[model samples]
Target: MGIELITLLIVVALLGLMAFGVPLGITTLTVSLVTAILCFGERAGFFIVAANVSEVLHKYELIAVPFFVFMANVLERSGIAKSLFDSMAIAGGRFRGSVGVQTCIVAVLLAAMSGIMGGEIVMLGLIALPQMLRLGYDKKLSIGIICAAGALATLIPPSVVLIVYGLAAQVSITKLFAASAVPGLLLASLYITYILVRVRLRPGMAPIYDIPETGYPFFKRLKFLKGIILPAVLTFTVLGVIYSGIATVTEAAAIGAVGALVVAGVRKEACSSP
Candidate 1:
C-alpha cells in the first residue's frame, strides 16, 4: 500500500479503537504493532517493537517519572496538603475570596513540590473544594480555580512532562525547567489576580473566609506558617540539587522521593505525638 494510504488507515484505526472505548495507550500500541508487522515481516516487526520499547525504558531521565509520582502520592496521603491549605488560609487573613486565593497559592506550592497534575488536582478537590463551597463561594468558581491552578504542575519546575519531553527531544531538562518557571508563575499570578478582581466586583461570588484565626493580628498568624515548612524544604532540595549541578535530574528525583518519605514520617510522628 502507498505510504499515504497506510497513514490514513492507521489514523482511522486509532479513532475506531478509541470509539470502541479501548484505552489510548493500548490502542496506539496495538496499531503500531500491527503496522510494523504489515510493513516488515513478523520477526523484523517484533524486533523493531522490542527495540523501541527497550530504548525508551533504558533512558536514565525516564526514571524520574516514577520517583516524582511516588513523591506526589506520599505527600497526598501524608495530610500535608491539608495542612498547607489550612495554613495558607489562615495566613491570608480576612478578605473577599480569600479562600479562593489561598487555594490558588496552595495549588502553586503543591505543584512546585509534586510536579504531577492528577495528584495536585485530587489534593485540591479533596481539601480545598469543599471548604470553598462551605464558605459560600460560587460553585463554578471553586471548581474552575482548582482545575486551573492544579494544572500548573505541567509547567512548573521539576515537571514530569518536561522531563519526558527533554529525554525524547534530547534537550537539557534543567534549561527546560528554568524556561518554564516564569511562565508557570505568571499564570498563577493571573489566576490570583482574577480571583481578587472578580470577588471585588461581584462581592457575592465569594464570601469572606472568616474565622477566629483570621481575626488574629497579621503578625501573630505567622506561627501558622509552620505548615508550609516541609513542602518548602522538599522543593528546595529537589530543585536546588538540580539547578546547582549537584545531581542529574534522575538523581534529584530520587532525592525528592526520599525527602517525601521523610516528610511523611515526620508528619506522622507529630500527629501521633499529641
Candidate 2:
C-alpha cells in the first residue's frame, strides 16, 4: 500500500480503538506499534519504537510537565481562587448577571493559576454554581458560563498543551507562552463580553442579587489584595522571566512551581487563621 493509504488505515484503526473506549494514549501507542510492525520488520519496529521513546524521554522540555502539574495542583488546593472569587464578586458591582460575570472572572484567574480546565470547572461548580442557583440565575446561563470559561486553561500561560506542543514541534516554550498570552486574554474578553451582552439582552437569564459586604474592618479587606498579588507574581515570574530572556523555559517553570508552592502555603496559613 502507498504511504498515504497506510497512514489512513492507522488513523482509522486509532479512531476505532478510541470509539471502543480504549484510553487515548494506549490507542495511539497501539496504532503506532502496529503500523511500525507492518511497515518494517518486527526487529526494526522494536528498535524504532525504543529509539523514539528514548528521544522523548531525553528531551529537556519534558521536565516542565511535572513542574507545571505540581504548580497547578498546589494552586488548586490553595484558597487563592476563593479569595479571588470573593474580591471579584464585589468588584463586579450590583447589576444583573454580576455574579455570573464574576464567575467568569474567577475561571480566568483560576485558569491563569492552575493551567488545568478540570480544576477550574470543579472549583466553580463547588463555589459558583450553588451561589448562582441560589441567586436565581438561569440554569442554562450558569452552567454554560462555568463550562465555557473554565476551558480557558488550555490556551493560557503555563498550559500543558503549549508545553507538549513546544516539545513536539521543537519550538521555544517561552515564545509559545508569550505568543499565546494575547490570544488567551482576547478569548477571555470575548467570553466576558458575550456573557454581559447576553445577560443585558435577556435580563431574565441573570438577575441582580444582593452581594453581602465583607463586614471586615478596613485593614481586613486587604485579603482581596492578596488574591491579585500572588497571581500577578506568578504570571510575571513565569512568563516575564522567559520573555525577558532572564531564564530558560525549564528554569522559569521551576521558578513558577516554587512560587506557586509558596503562595499556596501562605494562603493555607491565612485560611487557617480567624
Candidate 3:
C-alpha cells in the first residue's frame, strides 16, 4: 500500500477505535502492532515493538518523572501543602485578596516541589479553595486562582513534561528547565498582579483575610516562616543539585523523593513530640 493510503487507514482506525470507547493508549498500541505485523512478518514485527519499548524504558531521564510523581504524593500525604498555605496566608498579612495572592505563592512552591499540575491543583483545591470561600472571596476568583496557579507545574524546573520532551527530542533537560523557570515565575507574577488589581477594582470580590495573627507586626510574623522552611529547603536541595551539576535530573528526582520522606518524618516527629 502507498504510504499516504496507509496513513489514512491508520487515522480512520484510530478514530473508529476511540469512537467505540477503546482507551487511547491501548488502541494506539494495538493498531501499531497490527500495522507492523502486516508490513513485516510476525517475528520481525514483534521484535520491532519490543525493541522500541525497551529503548524507551532505557532512557535515564525518564526515571525522573516517576520520582517526581512519588515525591508529590509523599509531600501531599505529609500535610506540607496545608502548612505552606497557613504560613503564606499569615505572613502576607491583611491586604485585600491576600489569601488569593498567597495561594499563588503557595502554588509556586508546590509546583517547584511536585512538577505535576494535577497534584498541585488537588492540593490547592483541598486546602486553599475552602479557605478563600470561608473568607468570603468570590467563587470565580477563588477557582480561577487555583487552576491558573496549579498549572505552573508544567513550566517550572523539574517538570515531568519537560523531562519527557527532553528524552524524546534528545535535548538537555537542564537547559529546558533553565529556559522555563523565568516564564513560569512570570506567569505566577501575572496571576498575583491580576488578583490584586481585581480586588482593588471590586473590593467585595475578595474580603480582607482577617485573623489575630495577621494583626501582628511584620517582625513578629517571622515565626510563621517555620511552616515554609522545610519545603524551601527541599526545593532548593533538589534544584540546587541539578543546577550546580552535582547530579543529573534523575538523581535530583531521587534526592527529592528521599527529601520528601525525611520532611514527612520530621513533621511526624515534631507533631508527636511533647
Candidate 4:
C-alpha cells in the first residue's frame, strides 16, 4: 500500500475505535503502534515511543501543571467564594438587579482564583443560586448568569488551559497569561453590563428588595475587605512573580501552590467554627 493510503487507513481505524467507545488513549496508542511497526518494524516503533515518552518527561514545564492544579483545588475548598459573594453583595446594594451584578463580580474573582470553570460554577450554584432565588430572581436569568460568568475561568490568568496551550505550542506561559488579562477583564465587564442593562429593562426579572442594614459600625463593614484581600494578593503574587521576571512559570506555580495551602489552613479553623 502507498504511504498515503496506509496513513489514511490508520486514522480511520483510530476514529472507528473511538466511535465504538474505546478509550481515546488506548485507541491512539494502538493506532500509533500499528503505524510505526508497519513503517519501521517493531524495534524502531518501540524506540519511537520511548523517545516521545522521554521528551515529554524531560519537559520541566509540565511540573507546573500539577502545582497549578493543586493550588486551584485548595482554593476551591477554602470557602472564599461565599465571603466574596457577601462582600460584593454589599457593593452592589441600592442598585437595581445588584444581586445579579454581585454574583457576576464574585464569579470573576473566583475565576481568577480557581482558573477552572467547574469549581467556580459549582460554587456559584451552591451559594449564589439560593440567594438569587430567595431574592426572587428570575430562574432563567439566574441560571444564565451563573453559567456565563463561571466560564470566565477558562480565559483568566492562572488558567490551567493556558498553561497547557503554552506548553503544547512552545510559547511562553507568562506571555499568554499577560495577553489574556485585558481580554478576560473586558469580557467580564461586558457580562456585568449586560446583566445590569437586562435587569434594568426588565425589573420584574430581578426584583430588588430592601436589604436590611447590618446596623454594625462602619468599621465592621470593613470586614468585607477580608474576603477580597487574600485572594487578590495570591493572584497578584503568582502573576507578578512571573511578569516581573522574579521567577519562572514553574517557580511561580510552586509559590501559588504553597500560598493556597497556607490560605486553606488559616481558613479551615475559621470556616469550621460556628
Candidate 5:
C-alpha cells in the first residue's frame, strides 16, 4: 500500500513536470524508475521493466493498428478520393454553394474510408479549395472549408483515437466505430449547414459555377446516381456485417477496403469509355 502511494505520487509529479514543459519520454522514464525503486526497492526494479517490455511485445492484436494506418496511406495515394470527389461534382457544379457542400460531403466520405489528416487536407485543399476559389467563392470561406474538413478528418470512424481508447479500455472496437458515425455526421451536418446559411445570408461568400447553362439529361442524371449509389451500397454492406455480428471488426475492415477498391475500379472503367 505504501509503495502504491509512492507510485501514485511519482506519476503525478511526472504529469506536473509535463505541464511545466518537461519532455514526455524523459519525464516518464525518470518518474517510473523512481517509483519502481521506492515500491520494490532498487534491486527488484530491474525485473519490472523486463516484464513491461515483454507485455508490449506479446500484444499481437496491436499489429492491426499500424496495418490500418498503412492501408489509409496507401488508399490516399491510390487516387480513391479523387474519384469520389469528381463523381460528386458531376452535378455539384450547378447549384449555389453546392461546391462547398460537396467539399464537406466528400471530406466526410473520404475520412470514413481513410483517417489520414494530412492527406485529407492536402488533397482536398489542392483539388477542391482551388476549384471553390476560382469559381468566385469568398477566400475566407474557401480556406475555412479546407481547414475545417482537414482538422476533422481523424475524429470519425476508423479513427486512430477511438482505436487507442478501445484498446486501453478493453472495449469493443466495432462499437466504437459505430458510436462515431452518429457524431461524425452531426459535425459534418453542422459544417454544411453553417456554410450554406452563411452563403445564403451573404450571397458573396460562395460562388456558384455553371458547368453547362442547360440542364443535363435525365439519363445522365441516372448514370451519376448509379456512380454514387453503388459505392454507398458496397460500403454499407461491409459495415453492416461488421457491426451486426456477422463478422469481426478486422474482417469487416478488410471487406470494406476491398469493396472500395472494386467500386473505384468500376467507376474508373465506366468513365474511361468514350
Candidate 6:
C-alpha cells in the first residue's frame, strides 16, 4: 500500500507538471526517482539509483549522439551542406518547384551528415529559402520545405533523435538506423512529389525563375557527392559491423564516431580550400 500510494503520487505529480508545461527531462527524472523510492525502501532505492545512474553514465551506445552531433557541428559550420545544396540546385536549373525538391533532397542528405535541426534549419533557412522565395515560391511552401526537410532529423541515418531513442529504449541503434532508411526516403519522396504536383497544378505556387546555371563542373559535383556517398558507406559500415554478428552496439558506435570524424576532417579541408 505504501508503494502503491507513492506510485499514485508520482503519477499525479507527473501529470500536473506536464499540464503546467514542465520540461520532460526534469519531470521524468523526478517522477522516476520518487516512484523508485516508493517501490523500494529508502536504502534500497538509494542503491538502485546509484547503480542505474552508474549504468547510464557508463553506457556505450550513446556515443553515437555526441560523435554524430560533433560531426554535424563541424560540417555545418564548415559549409559542406551549402556546397551540396548549391551543387544540386544549380544542376536542377529552371525546373518548376525544383528548389522545393532540392530542399527535400538536401535535407535527407544533410540529415545523414549532421542530423541536427539547429544546423539543418539555419543552413537551409539561410541558403535555400531565400533562393526559393526569390524564385517566387509561396511563403508557405518555402516554410514547409525548410521545416519538413529539417525534420529529417527524426529519420535520417546518424539521426540524433534515433540515437537518443535507442539509448532510452535499449534497442540496437544500428537496426533503428537501418530501419529508418526506407521510410526516410519515402517521406522525402512524398514531399518532392507534392511540391511538383502543387506547382504543376497551380503554377503560381512555385514559379521557375530564370535559373542561371554555372553548374558545379564534374570534379566539384563528384567532390560534393562524397558528402552523400561517404555517409551511406559509413552507415552501412557501422550497421553492417553490428548485424553481421561481429561487433556490439558499443563497438559499432565507436566505428561510427571514427568514421564520421574522418569524413568531417576530409570535408573540412576541402571546404577550407581556396
The prediction achieving the highest TM-score against the true structure is 1
The C-alpha lDDT values of all candidates are: 0.93, 0.80, 0.93, 0.82, 0.72, 0.75
Judged by whole-model lDDT over C-alpha atoms, candidate 2 comes out at: 0.80
**Candidate 4 ranges beyond 4 A from true positions:** 1-58, 214-220, 269-274
Off by over 4 Å in 6: 1-55, 214-274
Better of 1 and 2 by lDDT: 1
Q: Candidate 3 regions off by >4 Å? A: 1-53
User: CA lDDT of 86 in candidate 4?
Assistant: 81
Q: Report the lDDT tens digits of candidate 4 across residue range 62-147.
A: 88878877887787677766877887676444667788888887887877766777778988999999998898999999999999
The pairs that clash in candidate 4 are none
**lDDT of candidate 5 over 121-147, digit per residue (tens):** 888987798788788999988999998
lDDT of 6 by residue, 26-124 (tens): 898878777677778788887887798787767776665676667676656656667677767766556688789988888887776666766788888
Which of 3 and 4 is ahead in TM-score? 3
Q: Kindly state the number of residue pairs that clash in model 2.
A: 0
In terms of lDDT, the poorest run of 10 residues in model 6 is 212-221
Determine the C-alpha RMSD for candidate 4 after optimal superposition of all C-alphas.
5.0
What would the TM-scores of all predictions be? 0.87, 0.82, 0.85, 0.76, 0.71, 0.71
- Cα TM-score of candidate 5: 0.71
Q: Is candidate 2 or candidate 3 better by lDDT?
A: 3
CA shift at 241, candidate 1, in angstroms?
0.7
**Where does candidate 6 clash, by residue pair?**
none
Task: For model 3, give the 10-residue run with minimal summed lDDT.
Answer: 52-61
lDDT per residue as tens, model 2, 1-274: 8989987898899889989999988998888787888889799998888888888889888887788777877776776667677776765556778888788777877776667767778888888999899888999889998898888888887777888888878898778888887888898889889988998999888878664554445555565565677776786777777778898877878888899988878777877899
Candidate 3 structure quality by residue, lDDT tens digits, 1-274:
9999999999999999999999988998998899899889799998898898898789977989899999999999989889889999998998999999999999999999999988999999999999999989899999999999999999998899899888878899999999999999999999999999999999999998889999999999989979899999999999999999999999999999999999999998987899
Candidate 2 TM-score, true structure as reference: 0.82
